[model samples]
Target: MIEPTHYLSSTVKGLKPSGIRKFFDLAASMEGVISLGVGEPDFVTPWNVREASILSLEQGYTSYTANAGLLELRKEISYYLQEKTNVSYSPSEELLVTVGASQALDLALRAIVNPGDEVIVIEPSFVSYSSLISLAGGVPVSVQTSGEMEFKLQPSDLEKAITDKTKAVILCSPNNPTGTLLNKEDLEKIAAIIEKYDLLVISDEIYAELTYDDVYTSFVSIDGMVERTILVSGFSKGFAMTGWRLGYVAAQPEFLSAMLKIHQYTMMCAPSMAQYAAIEAIKNGKEDVLHMKKSYRQRRNLFVNALTEMGLTCHVPGGAFYAFPSIKETNLSSEEFAEKLLMEERVAVVPGSVFGESGEGYIRCSYASSLEQLQESLRRMQRFVQKQKAGV
Candidate 1:
């Protein structure tokens, strides 16, 4: 019999499945498991947004949207970005809607990366960056950010990591896994480095609207940065619309045109009803986002305090909905800590090591669940930690 692997594309074959999903899968199979693993909002899409989608369907709007998505939706996105981030993009030429931020990310990488080109990835980030780069025929250079600097990417380290082959840098602020947001000061330093090196930037700002404390800043808002940055954002995290499968990219017309070509050939367009509903989301979803953010803030406090009281060192996350606590005190690897917690106490979390080697010794606990669920998970985790310390 012919081997199944023989027919697989070398790039696709080399890619590892997402580490975040592995623990989620395990938790799904187990009875009475409380999962803090997946970074998804627990809130349902706001009724108005859902109603708008339903209304669209009732009005016989099931046909495929334009290749660039609905003109009205794109215009709403353009207006929102300009008003919120101080960045402008022509809806007609500079914006392209995608299936999700995932597709926008893929499109951005594919449009810019060439074989052997290097893309700098800040580590302890979303798990897909390196794999996506590899699939685009680009090399991903990992730049590790540590707890010492609040997990913000250091300009000095980033400058040292760049080489002649480097083509682009991927940045996620209000970052996943770590929940650290880069401040304007830190971003200014990074902007200097990118400008000095003339590197393209793919700024993943999906969590921009989920920030807890400080005002969120977009990369394109910095001086001279808009010309070089491709901004990828969406309604998934902010609007509690993950299932809607809608996101978009904003860039200069020349760059967006290239991504549009790829999107037209592959995805063609995002879902029609989702696009219509997204217009409603962009226009009227502020209160819903604020309500969700308030809830997440309470949950973040609940989890972080619980972790600290249990003898784990946790940095208070500034934004997003995750609490990454060090598990080194338990004398187990991140995987060991997570697995034993799941088996013994029925709580699930993603091992930090899977995010990147620098993330090793910590486990990411999402606060996207409710307060009661978070409290229960914390109770189970506390018991698990005590048992580990007792050498059981």
Candidate 2:
């Protein structure tokens, strides 16, 4: 028989599996493993939000929503964005609901990228950015951001990465794996370069509500950026609604319309019940978000403090639930350290190298687990570090 691999798309064939899930799968196969690999929230979806979805099902509202999603949910999303970022999107023309923020991102890439277009991706970013860009037939140009700079994209570095073929930039503030929040001044500087280059921006703000020390600023809120920004966010991170698979994208009508064409053909619409729940979430879930944010802040402090005490040299994360700590002092590659920790200590984390070249020498530990689990994992990690140092 002919090999099935011969039939696979070259783009799909070239894509590597998610580095985060590799450890998660290993932990699943083992006994008594503590996994800090995945970035999901530890909290459950708020009762009110879940109840709304349940009620929708009871009302037999399981039919497909409009291709763009329910107008009510879109209106709520518009209001929420305006309230948070002082940027308003017309619910009818500028918003498209997607299965998840990931899908929204994929749609944005598919809509905007043409063959040979170059898209700049800021690294150590979410693992999917580069893959999705490649699948969109665009060359993913990585601009490495360092822990020395708090993983914030420097305007100079971004300028260096741009070229005549560069079409857009993918930016994730409150970035995954690193948890870095780019402030207004930082964004203003980057925005200047974006304007100078006449490039578009795909801003992933999924972790906006999880910010700890500073107020979350949407990239489009920067002067002269609204027209060029495609804002993708969802209910997963903040509202503990990951399993619900609900997210939305906000952009200018031209971009949104293009994405909508792809979304309509592929996804048709987001789940009807989840859309109902999202409506409730945006309307009444502020308190729930605040509660979860407070818990994550506390966990971030505890986890980062423990990592530092163990000599891991972590930068205190300003948002999101991850703590990216340097493991270079241990004299081990990130993969070696993470593999040894999992095998020897049954504590699972993602080696940062999988995120990008700049992510080498670090490991991403999510603090989204329970306090007790986090404490136990930290103890195990510390013991593992000591053993590695002692060379026994």
Candidate 3:
């Protein structure tokens, strides 16, 4: 008999499983584990957002929305973006509501990437970026960024990565795992290189509102970039609405139209109740977002300092809730360090090697847990580090 595995798509067979989820699954199966592995917000979805969804359901608004999503939600998204970035988009023509910012990203990739096209993905990036590119039939080219440089993608480095087959770049600010926020100056320099290459950019800004020290700059707001940028964001990170599964994409109509075609056929529309809730979220969720941001900032401060105090060198994250600390001093690979820490201390973190080759010596610890949990995890980590240093 023919093997069933032989019928699987070559692309699916070749793909590796998520590195973050591997540790999360192991921690999930074990008791007494302090998981700093997953990057989800610990906060409950704000009351008002939940109420809005409940109201929508009570109103019997359970039917599928338009393929692009409800016009009202898209309008709210447009207004929110305009208020934040001063960039205007026509809700009907230039916006699309997706299942999540992740879906928006996938749609953008699928819309633009042709088979064999090369897309530049900066290292230490969100794990899904490369995988989504491959699923879109594009080649993912890694451009390494180091902790020494605070993991910022330098313009010079970006220029070196581009070739004739290069199609676009995937940029995430207030980045996942590292929490590095690209400054306006950094963006301007990078924007110049993008213009020189005439390349497109898919900017993932899911953590836009979680920025602590500096203002979050939208890539579309960069001069000459609005037309070339596909802005992907959602309520997941900032609004504590990951379970809601709502996100959006804003781009030129030409690009939006293409993505909409795929979205229409595949997703049809975002959940109707979720769209209603997202409308409420973008319209009146500011105070709740501010509260969450304040809490995440406190956690970040406590967590990064604790990591440093434990003798691990960690770059202070400007946004998002993760702390990537080098584990090189322990003389263990990233995976080995994480495994030993999990087994010995019952602390779970994602190994940096899974992110990219450049991420090899670090481990990503999310501080999205409660303050009490973070404190206890740090104590356990400190003990583990001391033991490792003593060669015990």
Candidate 4:
């Protein structure tokens, strides 16, 4: 008999499916489920950005763009980075518009990794980092972060993870699941370690614009590190354009060239209409982004306060939309509690173990849903916790 598994790449055979998708699938089958499992903004693409896409279609601008993406969009992305983060790039040589930050992360790994090279990932992180590193033939070295430090990376942890085989370290600030952010000082300390070891960095800053703390800092903002960092971000979170499938990579000329080749062979280009819409959004969508961020700030406070008041140990994340609360006090591992909550209370949230082992006693709740839904979720959660305590 013919077998598909025999034909699959060794890397494909070794990888597990994403953890985030498990709860998403569960929520789909449950009636009356209020889910905080999704990480994307609930907002739709802004009207002007949608209109721009429509106009592109009407004008018959449906042809494929340059292998790198639209020239105009690349220029706009370059300007946007500088204006927002004080990071400069040459549109022609330093930027490549890929499908999303997801793709850019993959491309960076593929471009730089040789088999058996090490890619350092700080956990609990977005699941894709480990999978992508594996797919690119690199070994993922997980350096665990803790809830004690609000899940932020410490200099000692970074120091312990590096060796001669280390090629790149993945850094996600305004991080997924935990929402812990790395401020300038945090970046500086980490950057110093990377510089000392002569290692490169693949920074995922997709949530940069959503930060509620002081201004977001790009790796490019720090001295000398920009030359060795592949800056990955997308319009999905900030502009509520998750479905648009547009994101970019900004890197040194040599690395950008290698990523472009892989992107060309694999994707050719991003969608034409998306490129046009993105150009308009970058040039004039500041108000739209700001309006969304302001709303998220309010939701953050509501969810965090409710969780702590209910006696679950929680942290106030500096950025991103998630509230990570420790579930140990409930005497339940994260998965067991999450499963029970869904079956009983019908509220859907991701178990911390889905991210990595370090996340065993926690669960990630996204505030991206409406306030009404969040309020009701809290009431249900309170009941759920109380019942668990009473041996119900």
TM-score of 1: 0.99
lDDT by residue (140-232, candidate 4, tens digit) is 999999999899899998899888999989999889979998888999999899899999999999999999966788777888888989999
lDDT-best of 2 and 3: 2
| Poorest 10 consecutive residues by lDDT, candidate 1 | 145-154
Count of clashing residue pairs in every prediction: 0, 0, 0, 0
Model 1 lDDT per residue over 1-392, tens place: 99998999988988999888899999999999999998889999999999999999999999998899999999999999999898879999999999999999999999999999999999997999999999999999999988777788988899999999999999999898899998888788999999999999999999999888888888888888999999999999988999999999999999999999999999999999999999999999888898999999988888898899999999999888899999999999999989999999999999999999889999999889978898889889999999899998
TM-score of each: 0.99, 0.99, 0.99, 0.99
Cα misplacement distance, residue 341 of candidate 2 (Å) = 0.2
Query: Candidates ranked by lDDT, best first?
Result: 2, 3, 1, 4
lDDT of each: 0.93, 0.95, 0.94, 0.92
Give the residue spans of candidate 2 off by over 4 A: none
Q: RMSD, each candidate, Å?
A: 0.8, 0.7, 0.7, 0.9
Stretches of model 1 off by over 4 angstroms after superposition:
none
Scored against the true structure, residue 205 in model 3 reaches a CA lDDT of: 93
**At residue 108, what lDDT does model 3 achieve?**
99
Instruction: Give one digit per residue, the lDDT tens place, for model 3 in 291-385.
Output: 88899899989988888888999989999988999999999999999999999999999999999999999999999999999999999999999
Clash pairs (backbone) in predicted model 4: none
